[model samples]
Target chain A: MMEELFIALWVIMSILAIAMAIHAVLSRDLIKATILMAGVSLIASFLFVLLRAPDVAMAEASIGSALTAIILVLAIRNTKRFEEGGGEK
Target chain B: MMERYDIHRSIPAILLALLVAATIFYAFVEVGFGEAKVDEEGSVSNRFISNSTQETGSSNFVTAVVVNYRGFDTLGEVTVLFLASAGMGAIVSALPAGDKRKRPIPPSLILTAGTRLVLPLIILFGSYVFVHGHLSPGGGFQGGVIIASGLLLYLVIFPEWKAPHKALALSESLAGLSFAGIGIIGLAVGGIFLDNVISGLGEAGMLVSAGLIPLIYIAIGIKVGAEMTGLVARMKGGDA
Candidate 1:
């Protein structure tokens, strides 16, 4: 039962991570993209925990999601909010 | 609101992505996930796993490997981090400072009060993490980042507030010096840089058990915390 649950959680998180990554790339709004990227990192951290590497998970959560997101958002704040190339918003 | 993608561009991209995913899926199936790839006997990782506690006196094998067996690598990593922050600081300072204008609206009272209330607890927790690094999941990097996050919160809450630039730099320098100093001492005593030369490795799982590891981690934690907070301050357009 525990093994099944672990696999289920892993599958769900993996899918979520992929979906978030796709959305993050596709999103025209830079801030929204940054947030989606952070979500992907958060999901990846959860996947790390499921894999039983708590150390990697903690680092991923803190550095990948928290600090990286903040830095990206700050970068976005300093630059343009919307992507200027072809796609219609 | 839906943004439409050009079919010509997206179709091939989608197909390529699917192909890559399929390849990855097939590879994972062939090479089983969560299974050890290396031989169980005489492997370096296997040796570390089996003998880390006995060798390094750190109950957490990860900590043992990171702060003991591969401590020089960690020192290099910390140096890289320091260089990164220093480079960022130089770049930001070199940039032309624009007209200094105050924030249009002041920070909310609730947020300011909340930040003040939570900041100490965050620092305490970060300290706890690094202090117990040899026995727990967390270590210097994570704890330092956590501490920086707390400082970041304070900076965000108070736009007009200035960080004590001199004090932060002092602490960071001192921490870095101590880390290198400890390694030099180890070299003199044990004939190896960053060796566990603290004579006695106390009972395993205890706070003081990991001899030189905890000390190195503490130095790393302080150095990292200062560096990251300084980075945040620079990014936030404050004096570092």
Candidate 2:
């Protein structure tokens, strides 16, 4: 029963991860996309922990999610936000 | 509002997602479910589990792996961190002075006050974590990050809080030098790099029993903390 529950949770997590990845890719706003990407990375880190890879989870949470989010946010500030007409020309 | 997408960017993004999903699915299907039965008497896992207490004198298998079996790899990892920090510092230093004037303005009062109150205690706790890492789950990397976060808090809250550049440089250099000094001493005395040298392994579970492990960790913690703090300060355009 517990194994079944674990499998169910894993499936749910994977679905959420895929959904977040798609959202990150499709989002029009850079900030929103960045946030979605961060969320995906964080969820992936949690999955690593669930998989019993604590060291990899720590790296993912710290370097992958946090540092990448910060760097992307800073890059966003330095670059143009979005095309004025909402289309990439 | 729906907008026309750039096929160039969108295609790559979609492909990347697909690649990630495919890789994860493959791993889960191919690897994650395997389990092996162990013999009651003398399996490889059992032997290691039974004798690990005597071999490394560490109850935590991960700690034993990190500090004993793969000690050289840990040293190399520390070197990589040091190099990364140095590179970041050098790059940030090379930015034109006039460009510094255009950096982001300081965060507001509420943020600053809260950070100011919390940063010192966080740094203190990080030191404690590093000091006790061998005995607990925490380690140099965790503690280093904690210390770095404290410095980052300061940088965010007080953009103008000039980090004494000389002091940061001194601390970084000293830490690196001390690490090398310890290794050199080991080589001189024991004819092996990073050997225990002056300290003995003592009894198994005591605070000081790990010989050179604690000292190496302490050096790594200091070096990592200083480098991270320096990097954060430089990246934020604070005086370093």
Candidate 3:
């Protein structure tokens, strides 16, 4: 029973990760892209937990999602929010 | 001259991405997966799983492996992490010092108060995590990052709040030194670097039973927490 749940969660998270990865890459607004990337990292962390590696999960959630998002947001703060010269003036 | 919606120009890039993804997927399969069992005798993982507690006296097998069996590797890893943070500080410090950020409007009073209230709990939890490394799901690295996340929260909420630079560096260096010192002590007493024989293995499943594992973890926790906090400050472009 638990195995089924794990498999389901893995499938759902994998799909969400792929979709979010595409969405982040396609995003014109850098801040929004950063948030989307965090969402992807968060999902990856959850997947790690489900794989029975709680240590990896905690590391990814804190370092990959939280710290990385902060860095990306700070970098975006120093630059234009939108992609330049992409019909965005 | 890349256009906003250049469909024709993007086709090759799309195909290249698909090809790269396919290559990665093929590599994953070629490497094999799920074939090794934790209890299968003669396997390296099996030995780690079965004998870790007895050898390291840490209930958490992963902590045993990280702090006891693989102490040198973790030390090198932490040193590399320190170098990265130091490099970050150097690069950012070279940039002209000024408040270049256009921060969002100051948070509302209720939100500010709530964050202040919750911060201590987060810090305490991080402490508990590292301190309980031998008997729980957390250890120094996870707990340290969690603590750094708390500091990150504080930085976002209150940009003016700053930890003293000298204090941070001092604690980090002290922790690193103590960690190496412990290993040297082990070498002197047990004829092996990072040996757990520096202290007696008191009892299994007890907080005090892990010999040198908990001490090493505590050192790692302090060093990691200090380093990560400094890294956050550097990335935030604070005066380092």
The model with the greatest lDDT is 1
Question: What is the per-residue lDDT of model 1 for residues B80-198, given as tens digits with 9 covering 90 to 100?
Answer: 99999999999988877644453447777887898899999999998998898999998999899889888887877787778777888999999999999999999999999998987
- Candidate 3 error regions (>4 Å): B1-20, B30-36, B98-103
- Residue B31's lDDT within candidate 1 is 64
Clashing residue pairs, backbone N/CA/C < 3 A, model 1:
none
**Candidate 3 residue lDDT tens string, A1-89:** 98798778889889999898776766666898899899999999998887778888888988889988998887777667876554443
For model 1, the superposed segments whose C-alpha errors exceed 4 Å read A87-89, B3-31, B36-39, B98-104
Better of 1 and 2 by lDDT: 1
Q: Looking at model 3 chain B, which ten-residue stretch has the lowest summed lDDT?
A: B1-10
Q: What TM-score against the true chain A does chain A of each candidate get?
A: 0.92, 0.90, 0.90
**Candidate 2 residue lDDT tens string, B1-240:** 674556565788788778987998888885535354345688765766566556756555566667656667887888898788789778867875434435677687888788878888988987886776666655667677768767866765676788776787787778778777787887899898766554447766778766666676677778777877776666655353
DockQ of every candidate structure: 0.55, 0.33, 0.53
Which has the better DockQ: candidate 1, or candidate 2? 1
- RMSD to the native, candidate 3? 3.0
Give the clash count for model 3. 0
lDDT string, candidate 3, B75-105, tens digits = 9988998899889888888987656546568
Best by DockQ: 1
